[model samples]
Target: MSAVLEKATFSKEAYKEAAGRLFHNEREQGYKPVGLHLYRLPTGPILYARVRMHKPAAEGVYEKLIRPFFHDGIEWKRGEPKQDNGKLLYGLADVQNLPQALVIVGEGEQKADELTKIGAGRLAGVTSGSASSASHADWSPLAGRHVLLWPDFDEPGSKYVDAIAAKLQVLGCALQRVDVAALDLPHKGDVMDWAERFRAAHDRTPTADDVLALPMTKAVPLDPPIGDPAEIDVWPAPQLLSAMTAPLDYPIESLPPRLRAAVEEVHRFVQAPLALVASTAVAALSLAIQAHVDVKRAERLTGPVGLFMLTIADSGERKSTCDTFFTRAIRDYEAEQAVDGKFVIDNYQADLAAWEANYNGVKEKIKSTAKAGKQSTTDLREELRDLEHDKPVQPKVPRLVYADVTPEALAFSLYKQWPSGGVVSAEAGIVFGSHGMGADSVMRNLATLNQLWDGNSLTIDRRTSDSYTVRGARLTVALQVQAATLRSFFDRSGALARGTGFLARFLIAWPQSTQGYRLFKDAPDDWPHLDAFNQRIADILRLPIPTDEGGNLVPVMLPLSPEAKDAWTKFHDEVEVSLRTGGELCDVRDVASKSADNAARLAALFHMFSGDTGPIAVDALENASSIAAWHLSESKRFFSELAVPEDVVHAGRLDAWLIEHCSATGAPSVSRRDAQRLGPVRKREPLAEALQVLEDLGRLRVEQMGKQITVNPALLEGVAL
Candidate 1:
């Protein structure tokens, strides 16, 4: 009978007798018996059982006895285990029915059962098997539910609550912690102890209403802090890379008068960032005049007058509106030229058709003479050679602006159809994400663009297609892209884009967003400044581009005055000094090295666009220097931040969130548990590493004993809740 009882469920009488004997033994040993608890599925099947002795067994030194049961297609049988790891939370079967009720998480099975009985049907109670098992349990059932953690008045109990809170937070549960310090309970006391005291005082058990009356605080969200200014001077925290430096404003005053006015007017009308507007305007001016003139930076160094500008902003920043306002004149000029040159194009086509027929006729005669066994076919062959030499050339089109085009097509147009063109667009995805930038063509395309910027010739050698050499052609690129798209492009290109000097040639602007501050205003009666700007653009476009007999642009050189040259040399030396090792511009040496060239080009553009004749003046060079310096600074800020390690970036985010939480709660420190649950860094090891980084940076002081981080008081100085 004893062997049968060991292998199967005991009879009720036998079970009662065994439990009574165990209870008596525990009582005699001055230990308590917390009774037996059953682990069940939500559908009401008993999967396992635990006998809580509360005292260690003398023989095995175990605190509890676990008996797992298995079902063999019929009924549950003892002594045969089905599941090894029990992940379901204690009382999950009971809490699963009350989905809308607030869940009260406790430390042990006894406490969970007590809370459930006290709350009746109003509240749900659950535990994660034990204090250490919280991380392994499936907490999905509590997702989207409000949870309150009532930890015991001990260190282990507090850790248990923290573990549960972190898991629950990931499930999106609204959480709060009961103020255990305010209860005035003894050390290691818990809800059960308080209930006993309550029963002793009131002569009755406390209800769910009594438990709900405990003090609680709302969980803090991840955000930065506001603080007082006075403390910052004493304990200054280290600055983070994310907030290192703000971009300098675009130097609009450096632009020519008409162009500056147009930029300012468009900025006012569209309420976009001034840098964005100015970049587009400058690009438009470059497009109009690039084919007519080049800038001679030195005796042996000459480059195109065109500019490549990249503007980065979030979507809905009115990028398109700004582009349209600035490029209106360029579009109008193209349309007018297209209309006026229609007859020229028609005549060229007619001549080309007649030339092709004549050439084909000559080739046929030569073939017939050879087939007729005539040895004197030299005359017909000479006629064919003469026809090839006199073949009608295709007329150059007036299409000067393109939006979506591959690098091959753009090169073809510049080589065969037009000698000058610009790619102006607010959406850079079409250009950067296009097939022309694919793995096979990115290097070739980047080289081509680099050559165009340098005013060097491009030689296209194709075996299966018509080959051509593009010489003295000018190209301008003005692209506005979002930050994410550009970052993605950088990631895909690895180091090739920067290594090939493709990005180094561009003047970049990453201005602060002007999103929420843009209030609406009525349009002006008429834009006189814009009209003047457009008129200037049209006038520049009408100027004849110096070209060779093959229609290749041979832009005239624009030299700088003596005073302007002196000023440019000084600026160039200054930038050169900053390119040394340990210099502020060392990381961005590629961009800084080109600053002087860009300044010279900008000065030339300003000189020509302002209708100034002869050499570029000193004043224009000074203004251009200022603008170039600003863009170089922008490059430093952008690339330096990108160079920050990922761990440090995460640390910066966690630091901000910690400061914010401390400020909002008026708490001087935050628990490691709260940081993991409510802060930006959630994973355990990553959070630890981030906390270590913050500590190393002097932004935070972590107290391992209490598992909390004390924010540097200086960081909270001048900040408010």
Candidate 2:
């Protein structure tokens, strides 16, 4: 009870000092402090130190304050305190009582404290925690004494003496010398041993010489050190040199007269990006001509330098000028450009929606017509006319046909899986369409281009000039260095373009054209400027585009799942039970047998149709469906799946989800139930279990009247599904 009262008598701020002398080194007397712990705060990145920590205290007050930090990015792996052997000890004395210019200088608090045993009346020590150096007291009276640096015989002891003396000398205290080997202590014992020995041997205060002659004793240093070896050993970076060479390594080839002037003009700006240089020359030349509004200027006419030249260009004189420039002069430096047809094809892909629609619609029509009885050549011709005119085109059913438009369907399927869509050639603008496709890919593919439409027929919905120009970098040398990178790339490829993927064989145009090049280069400026240039170029050179516009994608074409089919049958019979007929709002209090499952499907289906950022966004699933909402939802699903990839049983569930939703939404445009019923399919037991899982996720509500499925629409993004 008295100890408790005494403990409570301490001031809050003075707890550290009072606790130190009583708790420290008193371990030999009992109640030896064993452990310590630190707590970290998140908001301020604050650290709180706790002394005398045991498992219970560490886990109680300390743990409660710091444990929550772990969830806020703090690490819990930093556990347990080290045992500080008796080598460490502490002391607390009124600093105002000490005298100046009086005693020994040492590094550690423990060693400095041993000065008291040597019979010094005005001894002072650095009061700090274990293994720490350098501290100060607010009112130390021992500020001006001659300090004797009595370090041990070892290297560290010698270093400590040197450091301590240096600081004491600066403080106007004379450095008293002490020989390391004669300090009369244990072989490797520190200042504490010397103090103990001196106390036992002498009855009064010891002089500098007496202390100096004592025996070898190791101790910590009182001052900061000199130049660190690590810092001194750091090396500087090597310098790059520019020297005059013996001769130019580039080939000096003869130039044809017609290409000579143009080549030289381009050469002047070649130090910049080719696109920027070309555009600058064009703009300057256009001013010189003063009457040009279109890309068909007389001065712009040129020829193919190689198949790679076309690969790098979309329209206008880039191809022709580059070709003529390269072939007309060996010095033309086309080798320097190193444009490959394949690179261009990889970068610039075509939209194949029109081709895919035509293929799919025709294939299905042909099959349906043949089954119903017949198809004529007139029908085929009519279909061809409609295709050219952006109208629906039905395939002709051959009298001897076993399949309808199977080959065309194969081509359509081949295109969807194309990793990098388009041809690898310059001569014919890098063919990217199809004339044939393998039979194996029909079910997997969605679209293909039928032919290379006439260049004059190219069109975009907006005003022309879809081409974006990438201005060259302003740094002349850097631009040249970047240009040289292309040559190195080509040289590494053994001076030949690479392969186009498996689709090349299907496209007849790919064989005749050179392939492997990037059609667009990086802009010297920002994206906005590049976008502006693209708009300008697109206006100047519009290429023919073939697409299907009217026959929009069926966004909600869901697969017929057994459970979903059954639910739809019941929901249709009792539609009024959950929703009012033809009303937008619903009182969905009751539903049964996988209705919550249907709700999950709705959410996913809507996410798919919503236009959102995700891997599936590349598919433009929402845009094609003209339903951005579902696409957005699919994107959400894609990301949520990132944390739990195995959540979806299979990809086919995406299709099944869509089917269930359209049935529930009761959209007028959607088709009704199947005529050929496979009635009452088996209920999925695992799926029932899956419902519990989703319910746990708060994705389903099973209270009140019955099970209620709620779709959190906010999670869905992009176009409606």
Best by TM-score: 1
lDDT per residue (tens digit) for residues 1-721 in model 1: 1232234443334433444443453455555555666665665554445445545658656444332223323222332233223255678878778766678999877888898899888777888655545554567878888898899998867767766666676688888888888888999899889899999989999998988898876643323311123421223223333333434556676777778888888888888888888888888888988999998877888788889888876677788887777778888888888898899989998999999999888888878878889577888888888988998777776788888998888988998878899988788888988888887789998999998888788899899987888899899999988655777787778898889989899988877666645888999999988889888888888888899886778999999889998999999999898788866578899888888998998898889889999888999999999888988877776776566665775576677577657877877688888777776566788788888887776567878784978886545532332
Candidate 2 residues lying further than 4 Å off, grouped into runs, are: 1-103, 107-110, 113-122, 126-143, 159-171, 174-180, 186-188, 192-385, 388-721
Q: What is the model-wide C-alpha lDDT for candidate 2?
A: 0.29
Q: List model 2 lDDT by residue over 342-408, tens digit each.
A: 3443333222456667756876776777677755545855785667676423321111101123323
TM-scores vs. true structure, each candidate:
0.60, 0.21
Worst 10 residues of 1 by lDDT: 225-234
Q: RMSDs, each prediction?
A: 24.5, 31.9
- The per-model lDDT (C-alpha) reads 0.75, 0.29
Poorest 10 consecutive residues of model 2 by lDDT? Answer: 471-480
